[model samples]
Target: MSEADYFKNMKHDRNDPNPFLAIFMDTSIPFDEEAKAIYLRDCSSKTRQFLLPLLRPLARLAIILLQIYKSVVPNALTSSKALHRVLYWGMKTFVSPSANHMILRHFYLGSEVLQFIRDNVPGVDVTMNPLKPTNLEPVKDDLFLIHDLNLYNFIINLNRELRDKGLEVKKRDRLNFGAITSTRIPIEPMPDRWTNFLDLTSAIEIFTPVYQMFLTDNDFWRATNSLQLDETVGLLASKIIGSNDRLALINNKHPMVPLTTLRAGFRLVLHGLATEQLHALLIELKHKQEHADLSWNRG
Candidate 1:
């Protein structure tokens, strides 16, 4: 189904607007070229700006290396399983308990990203740190459903308005609460060095709140199991990739796109995405008002 059709199915009060919507929606935020230029000036780092572009090429190389590792390493390991078993037995027999603890510490880094995103990102003004992730918090189950419905209704109405203006929004098959059967994914707590930037952590911080603002409020209910940074990030990232991919479909065809160039910059991208979402919320509200007025006149 088209995004508008899918959104129309969302549960929300058609007559009343939620007051707390402002926490997620900021219609006043600027997203034009002038605002983007200013964001670059305030938030850009010279070294990062230079090195960031290079990552695209490195990403390609990493993919190749990963393919080779998966293909070659598995067979090699299988061939060496007997030797490995002997080595494992010898190591267990010889290695002390204290030595194992030290080895684990060497592999385990602190969960700084989780702590930083949860404790710091949401409370900070995005205008100042546009790079930070949208703040997502665990809410009461009842509250989650209410807000989720509100956000769903807002998007549905906004898409209808956009369609009236001759815009085409495609169906996005990204992750959502209704579609999600399970939230079990491999949790790699330590991200690759390439993604271990402050901007990534900041961007991740915004994921939950941004996602909740867009999808069903109860979409993150599965995450209540542990709220571990890796698992939560995994859930959030899946939705984010889905949302971005949906936007990409529109952007690919349209001559003018939002946040196309600066999207490579983590902070800039987060702001651009959040700005678009907030704009949708405002459009939805306006459409609701217009409909209300028409109904009143008809009465």
Candidate 2:
């Protein structure tokens, strides 16, 4: 089946006994061979497994040190050069080329799915404000601070709306972008490699394991589980999306769950903020370079 057709036919049962199986049962979209090989190698590494416990404490120390560093030099973490170097080092040391390829490809595929939903779903507001890279300096830090919470709110709100309307994208008609008129088109186009900056996938892979340490089993399961197309429009939608509601109830003396989930959620929020700052800094630098190149060519 075509990629669009494959996504169209995808389904998930929210009441499934095994959430993991529900999310990954569709193996039609295979992982890249090299990515699979690297994943297997890491999983089988005795040394890596032994060092895994050390990472949790080290990650906490790094966080404390970063806070101190940021206080000492306000712009240290936000500096374009600093951001670029960190991204370079992380990609070179931690991320594999094949993994990067797979990450970018998933992005493109995810975008296609979203576009399909926006086009087909009635009354769905998928429109987002255009990112003003040039005017981002003033609120760049603030943007990073709330990136995770903002994403959480977005997913929750969108899902709630979908539920209220009794609408779903997966249940829609088959996606047919029409027959190709040109024989020159490739069956599958490769995504461009993101060499200059850290993408979301790489950032999540690098940081989430440490963040996972703070979460409860329920919260951890929620964090790790993947969502279907109809679920929050392909984002990691879960029961924990209702955590904010639970928090409000707890504040009103009607506690539904332990306070630890709240603490764990905040840690994830901070992780998202820090990751976004790095991403935004690199993006700002990229835009500046492009502008400079254009000006130089004109001169």
How do the residues 198-219 of candidate 1 rate in per-residue lDDT, one tens digit apiece? 3222222323333222222123
Best by lDDT: 2
Candidate 1 overall lDDT versus native: 0.30
The CA lDDT of each predicted structure is 0.30, 0.36
| Residue-level lDDT tens digits of model 2 in 56-141 | 45555554554454446644324433333443444444544433333333333333333333444566665432122212131223
Give candidate 2's root-mean-square deviation (CA, Å): 16.5
> With candidate 2 superimposed using the best TM-score fit, by how many Å does residue 225's alpha carbon deviate from the native?
14
TM-score of each: 0.24, 0.37
lDDT measured at residue 259 in model 1 versus the true structure, 0 to 100: 22
Model 1, poorest ten-residue lDDT window? 127-136
Global local distance difference test of model 2 = 0.36
